[model samples]
Target: MNAREVMLTIPVVLAPDDTVAAAVHKASASDLDILPVADATGRFLGAVSKADLVRHAHDPDARVGQLDSADILVCHPDHPLERLDHDPMSSVPHRTVVVVDEHGRLCGMVPWVNWAVDEARTQSGHPRSPMEVRTLSMHLHWRCLDCGYLSARAEGTPVRCPHCGAEQSAFALHTED
Candidate 1:
């Protein structure tokens, strides 16, 4: 299957001009790890992730430009999603990859977990099959928006944090492993 077929639609996105704090808030509220950065024309610029934002705690003046990686790893909407891992070093450290159309417009964001699954399936010659790596797991640091609690999880969405009655949307998900 191609990226268009497997890629999840672009979730919440933040503009390049948006402050790091705003990105953090939106990400936290949406329970997402990375926030796609776009231009005024909605062009896919780069990505500002939860990690990048947290790094800002040490420096609030940090702009998206400072934390954003201009080297965006993108795949054509028509390109096979399984091809994402064709190059072992193609992907960046923690930033979610952006999917662009022929015109280079931001179409979607492929999280690392989804990308890993696609890559693994392709490598195993079962691109359309379900996950076979039984021990496959990932860890992430999440911030609870409602109660401002910071916690960690292993691959499942966290809802109804103890400190607050908020739902999953009340937390921001950031991959740490």
Candidate 2:
């Protein structure tokens, strides 16, 4: 499934003209650490974090537009999770990803935990097809001889160590249970 299929719609959203006090109230009522900020037309502006509200505690009346953070990770709804080279959410302070349409309008929001759970499910095989079932039953341990990086896989060693980029030939397998 794509990101849109797993994203949460009807997320807590704040208007640019909203106050930090309003943002704080909304955040406190919801489980989200960050809330999407949009205009009246539904155009995504950025996001407002709880930390942002705390940073401006002295000025609770400050407009969200002036303080909303643009340092957010945005992805198209159709974008596949595997196509992402790295976890862009990790680079942002909010640790959330905004899903926008081609028009840059807000569609949904994906928390990092949700994305990680989906990734893990995909990697571990959700439906557990015949081949995947067999693969999941077997555990193979690998140790990179070059960098001493260790990993466990259901299949053979990878072409390279994800940690040190060492070749497969530089790995030793220990299939001990």
Score each candidate by Cα lDDT: 0.62, 0.63
Score residue 69 of candidate 2 by CA lDDT: 85
On residues 1-177, what C-alpha lDDT tens digit does candidate 1 reach at each position?
666665677667777776766666666655556667878777877776665676675554556766746334688877665555544333444335578887778888666535554554666687444432322235566666545566766535576777777687767765543
RMSD of every candidate to native, in Å, equals 4.9, 16.1
TM-score of 1: 0.68
How does each model score on TM-score? 0.68, 0.60
Q: After superposition, how far is residue 171 of candidate 1 from its true place, in Å?
A: 2.7
Q: In TM-score terms, which candidate is top?
A: 1
Give residue 141's lDDT in candidate 2 (0 to 100): 62
Q: Per-residue CA lDDT of candidate 2, range 112-169, in tens?
A: 5334434645775654233212221243366554455667755567689898897776
Candidate 1 regions exceeding 4 Å error are 58-61, 70-72, 86-95, 113-138, 144-149, 152-170
